[model samples]
Structures are given as C-alpha cells and as structure tokens.
Target: MKIDNEPDIADFDAALLLVMDAIWSARNVSLAARRLHRSQSTISASLNRLRELLKDQVFVWDGRQMNPTALTEQLMPQVSDIIASMRALIWRAHGGAEHAHRRFVIATSSYVTALFSAGLLTRVADEMPGVSLDFIATAPNSWTKSVLPDIDLFIVPTNVARTRGLHTARLYQDAYVCIGARDNAQLVADMAPDDFLGLRHVGFSSVPRLTASHEASHWHALGITPNYVMQTPEYLSLPAIVAATDTVAIVPGRLAQAAMRDFALKAVRPPVPVPDLEIVMVWKPAQNDDPVHAWLRGALVDLAMAFDA
Candidate 1:
C-alpha cells in the first residue's frame, strides 16, 4: 500500500491524535471516553472517523472486549511515537524550557511548601530563570475545587486522592516523627507512648479544626490521645514556638529534618504507627504531552528521588 505524501496528510490533527492515543491507552471505548472526559457515543463517533482516516478497523469486539486488529497492532507504536514527536515540536515552537516565560501555578499545603518549595524554587531559578512559580496553600477539603485552572502542577499527600481527568504520580513516602526541642528533658532513649500523650502537644492544624482526624484515627487505634495545648496552621512558626517552650509536634520526618537546625529539634520515631505520607505530583491529562510540563515533572521526580537518596 502506498502512503499519502500530501502535506495535509502529514499535518497533525490534535483531536484525532488524542482519540487514537486514548483508545490505545484504555483498550476499550468506554474506558477511553472516561479518560478523555467524553461521552461514549461521542468517542464512538470519533473512532468511526479515525477508522476512515487510518483505513483500518483498528479495534474490533471479541466477546465483550475491544481487541486491536493486526493493522492497529502494527500502526500503534508508530502513531504513538508520531504523536509524542508532534507534541515536542509544538512545545519547542511555543518556546520550551530554554526560552519559555510561562508561569506555573501549584496548589499544595504549607507543610509540603516547607519541605520542598525552597529546594524546588532554587533549582527552578537556576535552570529556568524566566519561568515563574505561584504557590497556593490548598486546604484539605478544597484542594480539588481551589486548584487554579492554569495550574501546571499540584503536589499533595497521598491521603488526598486524585479526581477523575487528573493524572497522579507518587513522589515519595514519609512517616510521621515526633519533633521537640533538642534540650527537652523528654528526649530519652526509652520514651513510652503515654509520654507523648502526657506532653503538651503543639498541633499543626492548617484548618480551624483543633484535631487532625487522620492523626486522631491512628492514635485512637493505638488507644492514645494527644493533649494539644495549642494548634497553629503554620508549621514554620511551630519551630519558634517549640524553641521557646517545651512543646512537641508530630510532623513529617522531612519537616522535622528541615526545622532541626533552626529550632534544635530532634526527630524521634512515633510510638504508634502513623500513616505513611505519600507525596504525589498531579496534573491534568491535557498537559501530559507538553514537553515543558514533561520536563518539569521529570525534574521534580528526579529532585525528589535525589532528596530521598
């Protein structure tokens, strides 16, 4: 079969490319529709058009399953590669990382900000000096709703699951550790669970609630209840407060490590097992193919891994 050499035939069509890519990734019409946020009928209609353009049945039903035909199987890898190359070319044309002046908005918690924003910002400044970053402190309940539409990326704890139409990748896992002033008398080798419950706890309550229900749940399961004397939204400020007074806070090991230098804090393993913190980077599927976004995501994952290492 002779391939069309017309310029129009060579030009990329984003919509068709997306449909084909989705179908390939999903392996089913309904699943593709869900991923693409299109109705099943709409996806089916698009598939029909794709079949005519590609001159192949592409996918066929085989006992309640959509199986790729031999033509599709042969074309799949090439088409996918073409789509990826086209996306890179488009991003390059629009000024990629070297020349791009794009602003990346991120929705994340203050705790995460304390742990990563400094390192990430420093790296970004050195690499993409023209690019700007806007960090918004996202509340637990309002993360999905409050994230800016123009947000390039969002980093949050794994406890916050991704909504439909979003792509998430786990960056790292952290565990809760008890942080206290280094000079605190309670810094002993044999610390008991009751010792933590008895101490005046400085709770990092980003919201109005005095107790973190997740932490409470873990403690409840262990038959331990923290006696929080004061609750504050800012983890950064907690170090100063704890430095002045002998209050302890249950915080992520990363945060504890970051604050240790300034506040003379010691990181001790929690007596009760707290849920492991899964840091995830999330973004919209629409931006998945953007070269700059891909670079930024890759850089972040690398940075996180390096930090962990």
Candidate 2:
C-alpha cells in the first residue's frame, strides 16, 4: 500500500465526522440529509469538502444505489474507527454522565451538608442519575491528614484552608448574624452593644482548652467576653436551644435563614464584629484534571452563586 503523506488532518471535528457517518450509513444524499434534518444542498456541499480534503471521491452513484470506490473502501475501516474513538472521547469529556455508575465521596461539616442538601442534591440526581454521593464530617485537625482514597472531593469551611496537595475554590461567604427568639421582648428593638454583652449566649465549641482569647475572638476586637449559658459541639442544635431559651447565638446567615423559618427567630446584625466565613470546595490536585471532578466543582460553584441571587 502506498503511504499517502499529507498535511496532518485537523483532528476530526466531531460534527463533521457525524455527518460523514450519517452519509456512510444512509448511502444516499437525500436519505442522509433527511436523517440529519438538513438540506440536500448542505449535505452535498459537506461531501464535496470531505472529498477535497481526503483527495478521493468517498461515494459515487451506481444507477440507483450509492457505492464506495477502492479508495473509499480503504478508508472505511479507519474512518469507522476514528468515528467510534471520537464518540467515546466526547462521552468521556462530558464526564460519561449518561452511563456513570460511580460514587463520589465528599468530606464536609454538618452545616455545609444542611445548606446544600436540598437544591444541590436535586441537581446532582437530575444530571448524574447513576452516581451516588457520600458526605463524611471530619474535625478541623483530623481532616488535614485524613486522606480517603475514594474521597473525590472535600467541601469545608475556609477556616481549614491550609490543606496540602489540594486545589480549593471559595464557594460562598457566610457572615455572622445574631439570632434571638421572635417573642423575646428584649429583641424587639435593635440590640445595643452592651445588650449583646449582657445577654446569656449560646455557642458552639468542639475543641478542648478554651481560653479568654477563644471566648472573645468572635466578639468585637475590644475583647469583651460573652456570658455563656450553654455550649454545644453541634451547630444544628443551636436553633432549637435559642428558640426555647432567651439565649442569643451568633450564627451563619444561611443557618439563620433556615432557623428563622422553623423556629420563631429574628436575625439581627451582629453587635460585635465577626469574621465572615468562607465555604470552599476542595479536591486533591491529582483529581484536578478529571472531567467528572471539574463538572462537579462547576456545578457547586454555580449553586453557591445562585444563593446571592
């Protein structure tokens, strides 16, 4: 066989290959145009271009039926292989969602889970029906080194920002706001700075070894310690506790919105300056180039951006 040395073929444009495949399968210009929902003139023009590029008449009319010539026969197998490979390449590039049966494991806190459960999961289910999700909550320190081989992604508060070998993106910013019982007489008016200092407060603290700095850190920079009546490790319980008791708690705005609907709670601007919490999505650098990971990350960031709207 003579090797036809030609300028490198532009990577087969998938659309053009599909058109060629349609013509090959139908074996008639009118039939292929009908199958492709295109005009016969358009199909003819594309075939002319294909013939010019390949330097061979790929198809010819033999009375009523279309026939392949010797050159076309030689190229048929290669063309079919190229078309099949191109189909798989497109599917994989699109994350193989149509046939994906893989599971994705994510490390995240309960608060993050609660915030994204409804809307995020619904989108995931609709787009990737064959994929399953697992969310694991890990403590700040342990999460740094706890590498699960199956964990495809990590969603955590940006406070745990310094993870080695991970790519991170800020999903959303959560600001602190004071929440109080809707019926509380003291909360009827805007809370004075001193009122915040005087009121019994509920806080969430999981770590041992609490110091004055720890207690005052969330408050204003002046370092006035809050009078703590109760402290719990679970942030989810804060809404219930504040609803039953007169205790006030500073919580993330998203949680405060959720709590306000369930409990008779009013969200107020915090009396003290508190740092804004950034929720971030993270994954191992090795997975950064994975098509599925990129799709999931884009979906998450898109969801987070919708919250602001």
Candidate 3:
C-alpha cells in the first residue's frame, strides 16, 4: 500500500503492515501470529515480503529475543499510524461495531468483572457478535507505561488511573460500605464510628495505598487506624474471610451487595462518611482517535450509565 501521497511505494499492503505491527509489539513470531490469528508460517512469509520490499532486515534474533533493526525502528511509528488510520477507515466503511471482529484484552479487578462483565457480555453478544473481551487480573503497579500497550483497556479507580498519563473516561461512582458476617451483631444498622473501629479489618491490597487511604480518609482525618488483621489482593476473597471472622471490611457498595447474595454477609453504612469511588476506563492516548476503540469506549460508557440506572 502506498501510504501518504507517494506512488512508487506500493510494494506494501494492509496485511504486511498488520504483520509488522504485531511482530514489533510482540517480538515473537508465534506471539505475533496469535495476535493476528494467523499461522506462524503465514507471519513468516509476510515478514519475508516486508524485508524484501524494504531492502532491510526488519528484525534480528539476538540469541535471547528478536530486536528491531534501526530501519524497522524508524519505520514503526509511521507503520502504526497507517494501521490505525486503516482500521478507522475500515470501521467506518464496514458499518462500525456490527462488523468489527477482534478480541480485546482488558486488565481489571474481579470487582469490576462482577459489576460490569455480565451486562457488557450480553451487549457485545447482541450488538457486536464478532467482538469478545478477555478480562485479566490487574496488579498494584499495572498502570506503568511498559504495561499499557499490551492491553486495550484498564478498569480501575481514579487514583490508580492517575499513576499513568493515559486517556481515561469515568465509568461509575460508588461509595464504601462496611461488611461483616450476617450473624455478626456488631454490624448494626447505625453502627457508631467507635464501634465500627473496634472490629478487626480485612484490607484489599491489590491497589496502591492511595486507593486504600482514600477509602479510609475519614478515619485518617480523625487520627484513627482500623485494626487490620488481614490483607488480600483480591476483593472477591474478602467476603468469605469476613463471613468467617469478626473482622469487618470496607468494600465498594456494589461489591458488598453482590457478596451478600453469595456469602452470609451483611453490608452497613460506614459510621463516618467515606469518599466516593470513581471507577474509570483507561486507555493509551495513542488509540484516542481510532474509530473502533472510540466505539468500544462509547459502548462501555453507555453500559456503565445503564448499570447505574
């Protein structure tokens, strides 16, 4: 394909650019093949064609990994731009989401999955049958620049989104609620601040301290610390732990609501007012103008609004 206005550079095509981009992003032929959903042999053939057309060794295996050559490094930025533009054009020409087919990898917590996955899946199945989502567990430091490119999106709290300078859109707002065993008498409807602090706590430690601190800002303002007897990375694990012990955990209101149905849990309003949790969808700015990404973002925002309704 002749990118830009040059007529003599027609040796490349859309497929070649896609192969180059996948290989450049993955650095492994097999991984690139998987990303493109093509056989490894097909990817190798495309790579060979790319090398021949460009008259340069695009990538070289340096014992441990495949390294992009200088020419490839210089050309990748333009190649990526071309690919993105081509995708946007195709999306508009092929009727947008109805015809779009790709698996999106989203890094998120189980809490988000529980809150939004079902509705999202149903929507995708109905409106965009060719689209699929893979929700992967996120880590405390998953917002780093190095990790942003591997996934299409991140559903995280506002605090976590600030760690990286990426594009973000608010999904929903929720508040913290204190949860304890359903049979626990300490979980009174109008439990006092002192009474709430008296019980041991279970903390979700998968995110940065900022999120935890924000959740417990009221206690911090009052110069008090909840007795934290346990800490776990997964939020879904807290219900079982809290149900078995006298410890109470501060979790999102929706999480508490969902947990109460599965486990013998009771959620009560926190004694002190806590900050609202603003869950947002985060993505790389590089994908800001891509039509398919924009459509997906719009769909997610719509679903989140409907969920709140």
Q: How close is candidate 2 to the true structure, as a TM-score?
A: 0.65
What would the per-residue lDDT of candidate 2 be over residues 1-309, giving only the tens digit for each residue? 435676355633446655676777788989999999999998888888777777778888988867777887666544544554455456667679787776788777677778776776787788768767788776546653446465777787666655665566668888877788888766544567787768888877766545221224545466667777777765778888889988888778888888788899987886666778877777775665455566567667677888889
In candidate 1, which residue ranges exceed 4 Å CA deviation? 1-62, 66-95, 144-150, 220-223
In order, the Cα lDDT scores of the candidates are 0.73, 0.71, 0.78
- Count backbone clashes in candidate 2: 0
Clashing pairs in model 2, backbone N/Cα/C closer than 3 A: none
Candidate 2 ranges with C-alpha deviation above 4 Å: 1-95, 144-150, 208-222
Q: TM-scores of the models, in the given order?
A: 0.70, 0.65, 0.64
Clashing pairs in 3: 1-12
Q: Please give, for residues 1-309, the per-residue lDDT of candidate 3 as tens digits.
A: 557744355566779889998888889999999999999999999999888888888988888667899998778755655566566666767778666788888888887887778888887787678888899996646456677678998888777566445656667888888899989887788877887777888888655454354565556776877778777777878888999988889888888888888899888888776778888777786776677676577677777787667
Error at 53, model 3, angstroms: 53
Best by TM-score: 1
Worst 10 residues of 1 by lDDT: 3-12
Q: Candidate 1, after superposition: displacement of residue 226 in Å? A: 0.6
